[model samples]
Target: MSRTTALDPLFTAVDTAAFTDRHLANLAAGTLAAVRVPDFLGNAACRAALSALDRLPTTDYDPGRVPTPIVRFGPALNDYRDQDGHLDAERYWRDAEAARVAWHRAALRPDPIAVSMGHLSAAWGAALAPATINGRAVFGGTLREINAGALIHYDDINREYPTGLFDQEVIAQLAFNVWVAVPPTGGATTVWRHRWEPADDHHRQAYGYRSETVEHCQHVTLTPKLGDGLLFNPANFHAVEPNPDGRRIAFAFFLGLTTTGQLITWS
Candidate 1:
């Protein structure tokens, strides 16, 4: 893997106390690699969210498709995608509603997802709404426990549903994750400066591409910390390093900046 002589200016991570309009704009415009907010949730809030996790029903992703054992407590749209890359709306909606009910029953105080969204909306200076299909709002926010790590991959709703998925025209998509618990070591996420291209398919493996896909691209790696929030462009290739120690639990969702300049969310 040959490395670039100097890192690209737009491939830098911005660490701040809170998510600012500038940071969000720069990220969406591909002028920034990522935005990290330390202590996005308070210690007490993190503890509360973590405590509620035990009571929530968690399930592993399909072992056949995902060799890694990722425990999660919400519906991910990709899981409902059919062979033709189309959404299985019926099953997705059912599971999404069930997950919502289970989340409420967990009785997590100061709901971390809602709190995170509130802060994001404040930064955007407008309310962030859930992206809807037709008139029905899609589910937002999921609790994922990734201790074994995830595969190298990129997520773009536009590419996932080429014909279009939501009623709003999403011009850009950002991934948001707030950690309630993190391992003592490892569990770092690495985002490469590369995006998908036709030639990259030769390295495709399982649900993601091989590491060689972005071997020569500039990248940024972020270690997860409790109460930390991260936002990054998901169109860039990224992967998570396995954590051999404690649990890595996070509340996550995707934010889509529509053509109309509204930030909509979905999981």
Candidate 2:
């Protein structure tokens, strides 16, 4: 008999067909991979979508006033801030629908975001067939640009999650991003295979869990190409490197399964 050592899932590829739903869920729980779906939408569609973002009205800094121009693309999610100077939910969704339509028209194909999300969900369900994946897995999250970089941090470490959230199954969950625009330089996402736990209370603060909290952890970096899609366990420590040459724009979301056999997607 052979034994399998528990290890993090790490994939680097141009296709994801080989991975099963269990694989993806397991990846979310304890794996990492960067898959490049070949011609998934192609660079042309990405360019079109990127250009279209400018046409849509953008909201000013978020509630805490982050000073970033954020567009809540697609339908709004719970707890989404009605930020000052930002487009309200109605306006935002209306524009998002318009943008998605225009981008698909320009792509001369189906809306990649829509199509991608559908495929992803279906695959996940199939991966857990007979379980009847039941839960709200809708789209709509922050779409924004960054000129510089982001400091090292772990996402969702301090989130006061609502009751019955699917991602609660595990202390970890997966994150998704479809890059519509990439800077000429310095736009890599840096991630440390580390996570937040009570052990790091000494350095943990309200603002964030600084990188130094787990200074000795090994790390990895990933840079997205135009039209590229990525998935990772965001609960682990991660950060975005600055892009000095140009702005980096992307659509982001969160994904996970529930202990009750429901796989969900949200932003």
Highest TM-score: which candidate?
1
Q: Which segments of model 2 are wrong by more than 4 Å?
A: 1-22, 33-39, 63-110, 125-141, 157-159, 162-172, 199-201, 204-206
lDDT string for model 1 (1-267, tens) is 466646787689888999987888888999999999999999999999988888789999889899999999889887888989899999999999998899889988989999999999999999999999999999999999999999999999999999899999999999999999999999999999989999999999889999888888889999988899999999999999999999999999999999999999999
Residue 18 accuracy (lDDT) in model 2:
36
Estimate, for each residue in 111-228, the C-alpha lDDT of model 2 and write its tens digit: 4556566656666764321111133223344466765666566555224342333333534456777777888888898777677788776775443555567576656677766776
Model 1: runs farther than 4 Å from truth? Answer: 1-6
Every model: Cα RMSD to truth: 1.3, 7.4
TM for every model, in the order presented, reads: 0.97, 0.68
Provide the overall lDDT of each model, using Cα atoms, as 2-decimal numbers: 0.93, 0.56
Deviation of model 1 at 189, angstroms: 0.6
